[model samples]
Target: MSIPVNTTAQIWVPARRAADVTARGARLLRMADGCAVFAVGSGTHHFLTRGRPRG
Candidate 1:
C-alpha cells in the first residue's frame, strides 16, 4: 500500500524535541509530493488510515 502525495494524513514521527519522552508519537502531517516519508531508527515505515478519509 502507498499513501498518495499532497494528502493530509496522521503519522507517527520521531520526536523533534528533547523534552518529548515518548520517543515517537502520532502527528498530523501534510504529505508532500516528493519527500513525504515515515522512518524510525534505520528503517522506513508505511502510513495507514486510522478511520475514515479526511478532506
Candidate 2:
C-alpha cells in the first residue's frame, strides 16, 4: 500500500512486517538492539509511543 505524505494515526500490521512499513516512508522513531519503532507522519507520534490509537 502507498503511504501518503500525511499519514493517519493507526497502521496495524504484524511485527514481522515492520521493515516493509519502514520501506514505505514511515519514519523510524527509535532503534536499539534489534527492535525499532516507526511513525508514518507527525500525527502518529503519540500512537507510536503509547501503543494505543489516539482519540
Candidate 3:
C-alpha cells in the first residue's frame, strides 16, 4: 500500500515518540489525553495526517 506523499516534505518521529497501532497492519502513532494529538516533523517526509492509517 503506497501512501501518497508530498515528497517535498519528510516526517521523522522518534521511535520512542511513535506508537504502533495494530488494525489491518502495523501503524505508527502518537496520542495525548487518550485522544490523537497533532504533530508535524522536519524534512520531505513531513505530513499532517488527521489520524492513523493502516499500513
Q: Give the winner by TM-score.
A: 2
Q: Give the TM-score of candidate 3.
A: 0.18
Best by lDDT: 2
Superposed Cα RMSD, model 2 = 9.7
Q: CA lDDT, every prediction?
A: 0.34, 0.42, 0.33
**Model 2 misplaced regions, further than 4 Å:** 1-22, 32-34, 41-55
Candidate 1 C-alpha lDDT tens digits along 1-55: 2345544443443333223322233343434432223333332334433333223
Candidate 3 regions with alpha-carbon error over 4 angstroms: 1-22, 36-55
Order the candidates by lDDT, highest first — what do you get?
A: 2, 1, 3
Answer with 2 or 3, whichever has the higher lDDT: 2
| Cα RMSDs, all models | 11.2, 9.7, 10.3
Question: Which lDDT tens digits does candidate 3 get at residues 4-51?
Answer: 544222223222233432222223344543433333232222323344
lDDT of 2: 0.42
Angstrom error of the Cα, residue 45, model 2: value is: 16
- Model 3 residue 30 CA deviation (Å) reads 1.0
Instruction: Provide the lowest-lDDT 10-residue window in model 3.
Output: 7-16
- lDDT by residue (1-55, candidate 2, tens digit) is 3445654433454333334333345556654333455556533232222242222
**Per-candidate count of clashing residue pairs (backbone under 3 Å):** 0, 0, 9
